[model samples]
Structure formats: structure tokens, C-alpha cells
Target: MTQTAPSYVLGSSEQEIARLDGQAASIEAATRLLLRAAGIGPGMRVLDLGTGLGHVAGLVAELVGPGGQVVGLDTSARLLDVARERARDRPQVTFVEGDVRSWRDAEPFDVVVGRLILFHLHDAGAALRHQRTALRPGGLMLVLDFDLGSSRADPPVPLVTQALGWVDAAFRSAGANPTIGTRLAPLLAGAGLVDVQTFGVQGYLAPDDPRGPALLGGVVRAVAPQIMALGLATAEQIGIETLAERIDAATRATGSVVLPPALAGAWGRRAL
Candidate 1:
């Protein structure tokens, strides 16, 4: 078997881990829309691949009602531990530690879902095959990820562009596809999934969005080491201490609408 290495851009750290919950919250609305598109509802068994901190899994649990069950899987035990802690009150939810390429389930699932997972994968195609096998007959598989290359700023914020460029470069250096979003449908089709469909959602940041300004700064800071190592940017260019301020100034001065990375979703069903 050919193995693909896992490249997690945000490494395990107390501060970085803490940020994930908020990041999840910021995107919760879009995720719910994708879930609806995937036909997630009561009495369905769900497998949440790359379920960081269990936010999406918990949402799926609620949508599936008490009769359904959700299994949240991840590669990091530390993150899974946090997921377990958050999901302790929900008996229908369980957290497991494993790699997506190799993890198996004793019983097949009705729906397999993931967010921001494929781009970081060594071989998204192989993972998609694994997901297909994990699904029961006629089961659904849905993934939400980004085409960072499609990201751009309106009226252009130099700082935002610079920051995002560094982020994209870092992902490439880590061996992940920065533009995996656009490729989701083809990848699903190649994996032999039928009725494949793809949808795209553009992100527009509001000044008050809790995670907007801070997220850019946090991501840059989190990947600071990699930025330096990759020579994508210098410490002064990243400007961790003042990125938020600069973004704020740009938005206020130009009434600029910050266009975050566009998200694309692809879904298909396994053969019965």
C-alpha cells in the first residue's frame, strides 16, 4: 500500500487548539447548509471525518436526533481528548483517534462528512475510497474544503494578500493542496462515487465577525515558523502584532469587503 503523510498546518498547541472551537463556530452556518445539502437528518448514523474539537459532529448529532449516532475521528489524540470532553454529555456521540486513510468501522455509516480535511491530506483520492467503503449501501459522503488560490481581496488590502499568500505557500510546502476545493468533484468521481455533485460558497467577512480579523493574524502567527522556513515572508511582513489593526484600517478606510477563501463542497453516494 502506498502511504501519504499527514501534514497538519496548525500543530498541537494549547493556544492553537483553543482557537479551533471559535473557528468552527465562525463557519457553523455554512456547515449547516452543507449538511442540509447532504440530506443529514434524524435517525441517520454519521461518521465525521477529521472532526476537530467535535463541533460539526455535535451539530450532526443534533440534526440526527437522539435516535442517531455520530463518530468523530481525528489523527490527534490530544484534539480527540478535547472532543470527548465536549461531547461527554451526548451519549450518541463518540470520539476516536485514527488516520482517515487507515481507519475502519465495524458497522458502516449512513453519511460520511468532513470539513477542511482533504486539502491537508497526502492523497485525498485514497481517503475518499476509504470513506466510500465506510459508508453503507447508498450512503452519502460530503466534504467541505477551500480553494485558497481563489481567495482575493476587493479594493485590495496589501496586508491581507501578503498574509494569505504566505498561508498558501506554507500549505504547499507542507505537501497539501492549497486549491483542493475545486478538485473535490473530480476526486469523488475518480473514487467511483455516483451522482457526484459540487457546490461553492464565497466568504464575505463582516467587520464584526468574531473570527475575521483575528483569524488572519492567528493563522499567520501559528504558522510563523513555517513562513520563515519557507521564505514566504519575513517576520516584519507577517506583522503578527499589528495585522488585525492593519486589516481593520483597510476595511474601514476603503469599505473593503474582505473575501476569505472560497469553500467548495462535493458529495456523492456509494453503490447499493
Candidate 2:
């Protein structure tokens, strides 16, 4: 039997974009690292998995210029639609709607990239294994995800911890590893990638960073209701509105909040 396409709630999309926009600098840094790690240049072919909003793919397209190609694959039509809309005039870029786990291409890619996608999978290790044959010899595989294990700082508010616990549970239910970033290097190595490496990047939603408040504020607004709807906490126990208010107040007071430390990258090259 044919499988149906996965659907994402509208709120999820907005939250994702907000997260990206809020963390734009970090994302950009990660992307540059991936490009440098992969040694991408004009005339190379790159495949980007989970191309949410397509900003990363668009950047790759520019890097590759007219001689190279960038294809972004995503399961969310809504996200892909947004990506395509943004990439309309760029002939070097294309977006495809499909499952990254099962999608096939006629030719192997020089680079395969998935930013913040592996943690969302039920069997991320298996998913990484599947990409082995999709890459050419010496090809690069790059991933960017949150390293939950890196979260060492204490939550400033007790309620914040409760809300975070709920969000973690919700992500776990969806088969995502909220802390997958820490295991990325090992995962890549196990997948037979050579020269595996990992790195960290941070974003603060505290008073000092201007971008932090707007970004963290957006995240709070986007995720508050979902956290409440998950049934993990009572409205009174961890009030969604209250969390928003606190995040807002914190942002205004500090400028941005410091997110728990996160791993920004894992990368390696396919063995020849």
C-alpha cells in the first residue's frame, strides 16, 4: 500500500520559521561550516534534507553558482511550498516533496545535508545508514541538531523547567531525540563516515543580546500553546500565557534569554 504524506500543523511551521529566524546567525554559521567541511564549490551537486523554508539550500545555490545544483527534499508540502516560493527565480535550486528515508536519486550527491532533522526521526541511526549509498565516494554528510546533553545551565524559573519537560516529552513522543546533537559524531562514525567532527554554537535570549529577545520571544509565543496542549502540564501548573509573559518580560529586561548550550554540527566524508 502507498503511504500518505505527513502533515504538519500550521503552528508548527510558524514556530519552526520563527526559530530559524531567531537563530539565523547560528544557522548561517553552521551552514558555512557544512559547506567548508564538504569542500563544496562550483559544479558540485548537493542535496539538502528537511529543507525547511529553504534558506540553507538557497545559500548553497548561491555558493554553487550557475554551474552547480542544489536540491532540497522535504516531507512537508507546506514547508516545501514556502521554499519553492522563495526559490522561484533561482534555476539552480529545486525542491522535492518526499521522505528523506526512502527517497532515491539517479545519481549520487557530492554532499548531503540535514540541519536539525535527525533528532526528529524515530530511527535516526538507521536514517543515517540509508544515506550511505546516496553519497559518492569522498562525499560529505553534514548535520546540525540540538545537543540536549549539552544543557548544563539551570532554568531561571521553575515554571520554565516544567514547560521544557513537557516540550521534551512531546518531541520524544514524535520519535525525535531532544538531545541527539550530543550523539551525532558517533552516529556519523557508525554510519561509516570518516573524519567525523562535532562543534557547538550558542544563542542567548538574555538581556545582552538584541537578537535573543526577539528570537526567544517568538519561540515562546509559538510553542506555548503546543506545550499546554500536550497534556504534560496543567494550565495552572505551567500556564502557557504566563510562560509567554515571563519570556516577554525576560526578553524586554535582558534583550534575550540564553538557551541551554547546544551542539551545532556533526560532519564527515564518505569513504572512497
Candidate 3:
């Protein structure tokens, strides 16, 4: 058997990470789901993997309160710097810069949580195994990620559908699993995690919903330039400048536009 390399780190620098964090709402629903799945509470030791800019870590910190400890680990030193800066006043939270693959600490955690991180790993199973080892007996592990095939809406547009396809292809080509949500339960089961559960959240991206449009548009805008630069698809195909226009037209002409519904979460516990 061949050992897989660690996942590719997306944000290596503070500037690069800030750009990703600026569009954090893209995964806000998923974040909430992970938080719920973890069942975090006061006095629980929490290990946050791939803690980008510490947004999720901050939330976990609040959940754990003063009595608990929240340690956020990521591969980017620059990102850790930003996390440290944000957590200055929060003595309960600590930031560490290291690869999750080789991470080991003095204390095992009650909950090990990751948001939108496993999909990027070349060997997600291995990473999950590592996370399991970091957990104390009977602790829970929660993960939230995208399930490309779960995309559904009231109405649909051809262009948006096409764009989604292109985006999925790009993700797979980049060594990321775009359909991690669907497989999360099985993956956890294989990792010897018992009592696994998964769920999803559905919504549409339309002009009527300011947050929906803003969140979706931010993601589109962030990656559109790169997609165009690669010539994977023309601006016309992705409707780079006219996504809102197209969505609005589709909703009016039909009932809704095909905006991929976000996957909610999946979690299981280490058997005691």
C-alpha cells in the first residue's frame, strides 16, 4: 500500500488567507452544522483542524468557555499569525502552526472538528485516522463539506448548471473531493467511528435574498478570475459578470434558479 501525501494547503500567506476568509459566508451554514454536530460545551478540550484564520476556532472557543481549551492547528504560519492576533484576549484559545498529518500534543481532546478541510486531503481517510487518535475515548469527530450531486433548486438554469459542472471538474483535478459529504458517513464508519449521522441544508441564491446572492457571488468572484485565467471555461460560459442577471432571469422565467444546496454535516464518535 502506498502512503498518500498530505492535503494541499490553500492559503499559505496572510494576504491569501484573508481573501479566503473574506468569503467565509460561503460555508457559514456548514460551520454551524459542524458546531452542532460536535456538541461542544463548557470545559471540553477541542482540537480544531485546518483552522483558517480561526473563525471556527473563535466560535469553538466561545462554546468551550474559560474552563475549556481550544487548540487550532493549521499548516500556514501566516494563517496562524492571524489566528493568534485575533485570539489575543481569549486566553482559552491557542493557535499552532503544523501539518495535521504529524500533529501530536500533550492532551487528547473531547471533540475534534474540521470544517471544509477533509475534501482537500489526498488521503482523507488517513487524516481522519489521525484525528481519531487525537481524541479521547468516546470523543466525537465532526466534519462539514460539499456534496456536489446534492445540488437542487426550485428552478434551474443551463448556464449555472454548466458552471457547476466545470467547477466540480476543477476541484477534482486539483486533488480535492467535491463529493465528500455523501461519503462522510461511510468514511467515518470505515475509520471505526460509530453512530455516524449526516444531514443537509437547502437554499436558493437569488436577488431577493441579499445574503444568498452576496455569499454565492463572493465565491464566484473569488474563483472566477482563476478559472478564466486557466481558460477552463469562457466568461460567457460561467457568466462571470452576469451570474446575478442570469439567476434573476431564470427565477422570473421559472420559479427558482439552480443554486447548489450546501451540505450540512456528518459526525461520529470514537468508541469508548
**Please, what is the whole-model Cα lDDT of each candidate in the order they appear?**
0.84, 0.70, 0.73
Candidate No. with top TM-score: 1
lDDT at 187, model 3: 82
lDDT of 1 by residue, 89-165 (tens): 99999988888888999999999999988888888999999789999999999989888777666777777788888
- Model 3 spans > 4 angstroms off: 1-19, 205-207, 220-231, 235-258
Cα lDDT of model 2 by residue, 142-226, tens digit: 8878865444213354444544566566566544677888888899999889998887676444544445334434444554555
The best candidate in terms of lDDT: 1
Model 1 ranges with Cα > 4 A deviation: 207-210
lDDT of 3: 0.73
- Compose the digit string of candidate 3's lDDT tens values, residues 172-207: 766788788788888888888999988876555553
Compute each candidate's TM-score over C-alphas: 0.95, 0.82, 0.84
Give the CA lDDT, 0 to 100, for residue 130 in model 1: 75
Better of 1 and 3 by lDDT: 1
TM-score for candidate 1, please give it: 0.95
TM-score of 3: 0.84
